[model samples]
Target: MEFYLKENGVRTQLEYGELDISGNEDYGYRPFQLMIASIAGCSASVFRKILTKKKIEIEDLHITAEAERDAEHANKITKISLHFIVKGENLDKGKLEKSLELAKKNCTMVQSVKGSIEVVETLELINLSN
Candidate 1:
């Protein structure tokens, strides 16, 4: 589980695998993608963990992520939005909302972003077999 990164004008990677992330200027995920993936992945993990504890069975989970960048000398991410779609059986809105709230409270990834990150979550119960 190791990756080698080099800063050659643009970041580059030397190795990657299922257990590790490797990248290069042309083959690696952009720094921005890493940031976005962190938030999205962490939120989903937290949401699922909390909900599962409350007996909420998730059939599907999807997240839509968007970010706005500053248009100045140091153009960086200014705001990020995460739209969550949760599908399950007998999903409880209160529990679903609570899971999201708890995720927001405990997700280190979201906390690390250090800016205004808005999350919009929707819960839908679907029959996956159908």
Candidate 2:
């Protein structure tokens, strides 16, 4: 939530703990990296919660996230894609879709960037018992 200037071109991000996120990539994580991570992490967990509450049993869940940045000034992220791979017995595509919709709607990070960023979701439902 806060940042400290360590030295020229060097800084640290502060929140629950201190992390080096300097302007120089050699030092630590970049701001954009953290942003996408926050988005992916928040939505991933939110989806888990929603599915659990809906009594959907799953063996595993994996997510891959990516972002696209604008070419103009600011070069901010314009779109984000979240791909979910769910492994389970008798996974309901309809229920899974509904859960993802709810997660996208409710995730705090997603909601925060709702107006500025376009978020996309995809899923691969794998039935191990098949």
Candidate 3:
């Protein structure tokens, strides 16, 4: 992808649309935010696929990510925590937990940053039957 230098940041045009990246949030998305998003999005997608393959139906799935950055070292991301809120009927907690483990193992983005960034995943299940 080619990025053109803008006033404050850089802009890239893609098939879907244009992407603006900047250090300043006022101009565009921050680099760290995008990194966290990539990790979380990849994990969630892989987890959902694993569940589907196991015939687990879900009403909804949401993921929240928190990143810990070190101020002393160029504000680099040191760790990321991902919390998953899963809403479904008759959801097996054990199976979901296993699926999450498998997702962590298989997610490309998670694997990419394995040695550099610590990734932690947690799950909260909401049973529709309740």
lDDT of each: 0.69, 0.89, 0.96
lDDT of 1 by residue, 29-70 (tens): 567677788888998898888877877788888888887788
lDDT of 1 at 69: 80
> Per-residue lDDT for 106 in model 1?
83
Name model 1 segments beyond 4 Å from true. 1-25, 115-130
Model 3 C-alpha lDDT per residue in residues 1-130, reported as the tens digit of each score: 9999999999999999999999999999999999999999999999989998999999999998999999999999999999999999999999999999999999999999999999999999999998
The TM-score ranking, best first, is 3, 2, 1
Candidate 2 accuracy as TM-score:
0.89
lDDT of 1: 0.69
Candidate 3 clashes between residue pairs 3 or more apart in a chain or in different chains: none
Candidate 3 TM-score versus the reference: 0.97
User: After TM-score superposition, what is the CA distance of residue 30 in candidate 2 from its true location, in Å?
Assistant: 0.7
Which digits, one per residue and each the tens of the lDDT, describe model 2 over residues 1-130? 5556776444554566668775567877788888889999999999999998999999999999999999795889999999999999989899999999999999999999998989899999998878
Among all windows of 10 consecutive residues in model 1, the one with the lowest summed lDDT is: 16-25
User: Against the true structure, candidate 2 has what lDDT?
Assistant: 0.89
Candidate 2 deviant stretches above 4 angstroms: 8-16
The regions of model 3 sitting more than 4 angstroms off are: none
